[model samples]
Target: MAITPNYYETLYITRPDIQEEDLAKIQQKLQDSISSNEGEIIKADKWAERNLAYEIQDHKKGTYYILVFKALPNASKEVEKHLQFYRTDILRFITLKTTEEAVNKNKASEEKKEKTEPTTPTPPPAAPPTTTAAPTPPPAAPEPPTAAPEPPPAAPEPPTAAPEPAATPPTEAPASTEEAKTENTDTQEEGGTN
Candidate 1:
């Protein structure tokens, strides 16, 4: 039986508040630890600052880094322990065992892209030649007639309904004086009969 090392990819994030010098020191520490543990690093990159999907350890943003390496299982554990216990600048981290083929594939693609891209920066476009003659001022565009702005047409009024007939309260007719006298006399005659 032969012991074999495994490939791993570790993605870690550091607190955004740290200075660039401090960040460099952290990366150096990780590299040193990996080497000390007999781990061979294949790739290491700082991914720059990014906003976190959610805050971790009171940090809403963090600088990300990725490390890919081949190491014995125990060696990987040691690296993780170093980060988990010693690196307070780090906000979060995850390590995943990956295939060597995947790592090689990614490396190959990156190399191909670099080779295909242009290396030299194109020169800035030459400035237009300056003329010594006084440039004729472009004829002032005829000032459009300055007619006073017509006021916006008043909005059409909503159609009004026909005025409804006024409601009249029923009124009682007043009794004539002659009619009142006759009614009183009839009441008196009835009283006399009773």
Candidate 2:
């Protein structure tokens, strides 16, 4: 049986606090592991730090790295095992087989778009007339006849009390304290007689 090389993409996140030197070391180790397993790396890129959709291992953000390579099916397992050994450094990881045809298609489409797109620089706006002409004063309108100054406004009167609202008849009058007590005694007496 002939072994076929499969294209795979691995996306992994490292702890946010990892130093640049340590990060580079991790990347080197991953690349070495892939090469040792007879895998060829197509791209290894750091996608920069991003906020996680949800916290992982107390991490609110992590540095993302993607590795696209061609390897045997078993090589993916080996790579994943190697990454698992460095659990403390990595927050999460996922490896998936991808079709080379899809990648090629995307590249061709991007190239086509670039070729079809126009790159004309926008022309700067036309400048205003350089010659400064003296502005003419607007024609003066006829002046209105002057009137004697009116006396100052008189002091405002104090506000009157608000009108009382109309009283609506109550459905039932409240019983006085004495009446309530008598009613309570009558109920008690009736209960006793019963």
Candidate 3:
């Protein structure tokens, strides 16, 4: 049987506090693991640090990194296991398979953008109209109304107090009272005997 290589992209976030040296070390370790499994690294890049949508391991923000590689089927399992074991360094990670169709589509769109971008400059503001028209006096401001208009009636004031708390059920209150009475009688009997 012929073995087929799979292309995968993994995005992971590292704790924001990790030092530069340690970050580099972690990257090297991942690269080594991939190579040892006969995988080829196509790209490894770090994106800008950003705030996470939710906290992970008490970290509010993390540095994002993406690794694109080609590997055998089982290589992904090993990579995930490694990241899981290093919980302190990695906050979160996800790996996804890249399909040939998607990659081709992306390349086509990028080429189209590049080809069209330079040819269009913001069409210079429509050349000023070639002919000028006689300037008309700005329409005279509407004559002020003869008398000041009456002010609108004041709006009703909102109620000052908050809505009353929901009423408790009658049955619940009686049950609690009965329990309290029983406890009080027991305490009274104990005091008298002593």
Native-referenced Cα lDDT, model 1: 0.67
lDDT of 2 by residue, 29-79 (tens): 778777877789877878678999999999999999988888878778877
Task: State the C-alpha lDDT per candidate.
Answer: 0.67, 0.69, 0.68
Using TM-score as the measure, which candidate wins?
A: 1
RMSD each, Å: 21.6, 21.0, 21.7
- Residue 135's lDDT within candidate 1 is 53
Worst 10 residues of 1 by lDDT: 161-170
List the candidate 3 regions with Cα displacement exceeding 4 Å: 104-194
| Runs off by more than 4 Å, candidate 1 | 119-194
lDDT of each residue in 115-149, candidate 3, tens digit only: 88876665434434422332333344433331222
**TM-score of each prediction:** 0.57, 0.56, 0.55
The alpha-carbon lDDT assigned to residue 169 of candidate 1 equals: 13
Can you tell me which runs of candidate 2 are displaced by over 4 Å?
106-194
Q: lDDT of candidate 2 vs native? A: 0.69
